[model samples]
Target: MRNGNRRGKPVEKARHFWPTTKRLISYLRPWKWGVLLSILMAIVSVALNIVSPKILGQATTDIYDGILKGVQQMKLGLHITKYPIDFNHVGQICLIVVALYILSGLFSFGQQVLMTWISQKVVYNLRQDFKEKMGRLPIKYYDQHSNGDLMSRMVNDMDNISGTLQ
Candidate 1:
């Protein structure tokens, strides 16, 4: 059957999602601080990106005002001379925009790095637990199961999980 949910679990399997979600949450609980900080950084980055257009508009407004001021002075019979470019203010705005974008990029990169670390830490814990569980299982259990199938399931499933998280 075609999948309904994005995760591809059928209605029957949907019943398992909550418990699985709870288990995953338990695994992630240890890295709550990293998760929180990453979210904060993401929010700040988005906010900066959103504000950039308005700041750019303000820059054009400032240039327009400068031009109008220069024209008025020319009409008043002063030297028909200097272009009214405020290099200092324009330079400051350019620096501010550049800094904001740079900071946003830094924060986004930091968040990705932190998230990767957290996911790896969680995967490490899960693998350790799986190893311990395997050690505790009886030889009879191993005899009942295909060793190659078990190994493939564990390794492939874990890899899929790690890929999804990262």
Candidate 2:
């Protein structure tokens, strides 16, 4: 049906979603390792992103405490011999937060690349299988189905499948 409409025809619903889903998943069997690795990378990236904010908060707290201490010393009218702020500690915390963010970004990028590669490979294999099946089909099948519908299934549907996989 074009645009989800079949004129006077009734709509068809999926009667076995789980079985269909399992079949789709079978296509990913060859690249299971890649899928697992991509999932791991995504988890690590999210964890790093989550932890960085807390680390940065520690630095903010340090700065605030240092400023408060300096203000107190000023009120006491004592000669401030040393700076209240421990710049070294704050600097180290900032560096750690920066490193974490960079690592998170790297992991995220790696996940995207791996997933895209896996999805494209799956789509390529599927297209090859479809071509082979089409070649074996009887000529009568072609006469019954429109060329546009066949091409739509061959190209657009495969592209949609690839997108869904990614």
TM-score of 1: 0.73
What's the lDDT for all of these models? 0.83, 0.90
Query: Per-residue alpha-carbon lDDT of model 2 for 51-125, expressed as tens digits?
Result: 999999998998899988888998899768765888899999999999999999999999999999999999999
lDDT of 1 by residue, 57-164 (tens): 777778998889999998898885676878788777888888888888988888788888888988889899889999999999999999899889888867876777
Consecutive 10-residue window with the lowest summed lDDT within model 1? 5-14
Candidate No. with top TM-score:
2
TM-score of each: 0.73, 0.85
Q: Considering only N, C-alpha and C atoms within 3 Å, which residue pairs clash in candidate 1?
A: none
Global CA lDDT computed for model 2: 0.90
